[model samples]
Target: MMKVPKGKTVLVKGVASIKGECEVLGARLNFFECEKFVPVFCIEDCEIEINGEFRILDGSTIPESWKKLAKMDWETVFLYGGVDSGKSTLAAYLANKVGGAYVLDLDIGQADIANPGAMGYGFAKDVVSLSKVSMINGFFVGSITPQGREAKCLQGVARLWKELRRLDGRKIVDTTGWVKGRGAKEYKLAKLEIIEPDLIASFEGKPFDWKTFEVEKGYVIRRDKIDRAKARFESYQKFLRGARILELERDRINLKPDLFRGKDVTQFIESVLGV
Candidate 1:
């Protein structure tokens, strides 16, 4: 049985590019200009209240223990970095700092939490239940398969954003760095525009030359090598027009497993989160 959120109207952002409906609940959804959907359901039979005032729940800080901090104004934060740039470390650290902010593991293709064949459920799982967290592990889409998994993953992310907006805490989105930091595909790019968090914090040691790429049907396409080399001022004009950008500098770390051997991830967490 599908659960329809009750009362106060579930406000969805952006509009869907395609026409669709909630298969289980049978709610009609409309596609808006930006290709997003705002689906609202009337859950008259359920006891769950859809009011805006709900508390976040992650074990780092209980909702009851910190009413003042928990009730503070919430902001959605995004942690993005190339492979091995410590995006997850930063996300966990920040989530811990804010007490009970939600942490979504958006690295679905290369997931580390809340996926099959992993060890015990980790902090990521608890974060989803008690906070505004959604889809902590990357979606299950095999690169070699002929399936439509990538498209589904994109929809999943959009749905997650809609759900997160309903909760009362901050949102921390963890992104994947597929193919050397480029996003996975066109679908991922579409979802990015829809989620549109308050902050997009990029962690990279090397100075980012935004003009080195061009947007071709949503994906960032590399420019001609020689042309890029000689350019004095490159234009990341397309991305700049779409959203604000924030870059963070940290000691460069590679995604290679061996280099990070025996490192205490918790210590990294403390460095970012601070006690």
Candidate 2:
């Protein structure tokens, strides 16, 4: 419980002891711990050493670059990076900075603008959680994964890219950390071809055939850190907490039409409930 005066930078070692916005002079962080539901780090021995006049700690590897990019007429901006590379944070930051832009999150697995198993497009009006705006247009992939579902995932991106064309602003496509091997490269190439963004930003790994900008750092947001699984579990439960329940008549919707073909599986429902 110490005051980090303005203009005085603070040093943090991935601890919860420090709070308030200060330029990250340096930080070593990890997304998740090996344990199932453990905290990301132990902050008991952490310390924040301040120096000089307090200043807004918003400096990043691409602050000026983002400013310049935001001023440009690039209608569609694409971001590619590895895991925990701050892709979502950058998209949200740039969407707010650029103004009048919609962030179309294509990271179905680690989705920001939507739940874990869906693609979503929404505007980043404020610094709120991206999930708050996840309801704009959610395309489900039926699984909390994107490894073998590249087709559906890319289709989601391409479909939403078309939907973005209906809007009157820029589009920021935040991608996943699927830039590992040959198949992934090909899949990403397909995504690039579908979106055909005017500008590409890469925080890590190389993406081909575009007017690309390389951002070395800004790989993680400095505000909050948590365990990945814990965060997902919380989000999953939060999503279903107040979910709407629907009741339909038995004849109103077919319960697996194929499964009941040439048979009367519904006989059980009829015999038991006599619906």
Candidate 3:
């Protein structure tokens, strides 16, 4: 049975997209701009408090451990979840909170920092919309979904992180909202192995069972729910407005299983673009 009681205790399992207004017992979910409460949940022994009161989780995408890490000079953070889960919003928020950091956006579609069908990496100098963060480099994933492009996505993620690791301050990987099926799970787990980030934080949805890493799930109440088409269009518009074009140097790119092992960079780019 679904959650019947609405005092504060809500037992959410499977997948439930919140349409009307809803609240979590002790979740501080005021850090997003769109419909972000939708959850693709898997309940085991997971139990939440039901105080029937409003309290602040302190508006953080990370768990309490993040606070201690924040006091340090820097760290590597990864924010991941399904669509409308506020992954991008929280990542941007933390980037600003952490003073400065290198943000690597792995969302192929509706990417916050680069054009669709690619992964972008750059340094966040200040708190701003993801589109405003100029992309220092990118790797083409060739497809919006990582079904056939799983290898490409993994390579892109590893390459981007390696290329940007030299930058000072915290490092962040803003992953896609593609946590649905078996393929998605395998792809994310594989990608995480390559990323090996210090912190593996997820938004409202936690699909993978990577218990060893112990994902930190954050909750938020999203007001707007934008689809992929709109998100992509909006992101592109932002990039076109003031983003200065920058070229990717081949030597800087680090792909373990090079997609273009025998092909030149131009050929690889053209192939990925399907041109």
Candidate 4:
């Protein structure tokens, strides 16, 4: 793998890395070409500025265009996996790092995050995990199109996702099962739900659409779900896998705290024009 340069756009095939003076214009190759590749990664529409301003495209925490994500009032990161795929464990890891975030165990069917006996204080934030009984006849009207079922689940999910989206602090939402059949289908729906969220992730071996996720978002979807979930006794005992939990712990620690920490008491007091 060659390192890609900063200004010029070049395309390479196979397992090659780009380094120095270029952007990835395009390339064809085996392996998952589009798995985590986004349209922005395609440099076809770009032109080098005179005086050759350099831009680092590979593995950027926040892309130049997406730096505004840093300004969001709340950064939402969602997690999904099969039953016992360690969704909660990973959630705790993120919550702990964020210094008082909220966690929504949206696994209404099987609420593991709602463990009543003893909760892990390693999580740094205030946590709220809910368990709602399934309403009779609540499934999507037709088992037909993913969109139709999506429409049904959307309202059900929106009820929580919206409220979850709005809290004053950082957020981590652990989504329900890949209860659906297809990985591609599950991936599509998850992406739609977290339109503005800073990160959307799932565990490994869970049939998530990593291909589409990357195409939609520029950065690679991290997969630490397996190890994180395995650390928890829950998912490991079940012999389950293929969830798509993101965050490498490195990124979790490296994230800008100011973006996640919410407004200070003084800032709030100032908002009211107080002395």
Q: Top model by TM-score, which number?
A: 2
lDDT of 3 by residue, 1-275 (tens): 23332233233322333322433222223122222222222222223333222232222234453344345443776676777676665666567666667789888876767788888987765433566578999988767777787666766876787778777667878888888788887777777777677666765434455422323444545434455577676666755697688999999998698454554545554444445
lDDT per residue for candidate 4 within 109-148, as digits (tens), equals 3344332211111123322212211111122222222333
User: Would you list the clashing residue pairs of candidate 2?
Assistant: 6-53, 6-54, 6-55, 7-53, 7-54, 7-55, 8-53, 8-54, 23-57
| C-alpha TM-score for every candidate | 0.38, 0.68, 0.57, 0.35
Model 1: residues with Cα > 4 Å off, grouped in runs: 1-74, 116-149, 179-188, 205-275
Q: Candidates' lDDT values, in order? A: 0.39, 0.60, 0.59, 0.38
lDDT of 3: 0.59
Against the true structure, whose lDDT is highest?
2
**On a 0 to 1 TM-score scale, where does candidate 2 land against the true structure?**
0.68
Q: Give candidate 3 regions above 4 Å deviation.
A: 1-74, 204-227, 237-275
Query: Which regions in candidate 2 have their CA more than 4 angstroms from the true location?
Result: 1-3, 8-64, 132-134, 219-226, 244-253, 256-275
Q: Per-residue lDDT for 148 in model 4?
A: 34
Mind giving the per-residue lDDT tens digits that candidate 1 earns over 1-275? 22333332333333222222321012222322211122233334222222232222212121221223223354875555555454554454455546545666656433434342111112332221211233333334433221245444554565566666677767767766552424344433454566666655554432232211111111112335454333212222321356767675655644555765643644632332232
Cα RMSD of all models vs. native, in order, equals 20.6, 11.7, 12.5, 19.4
**Ten-residue segment with the worst summed lDDT in candidate 2?**
32-41
Going through the candidates in the order shown, the clash numbers are 12, 9, 2, 32
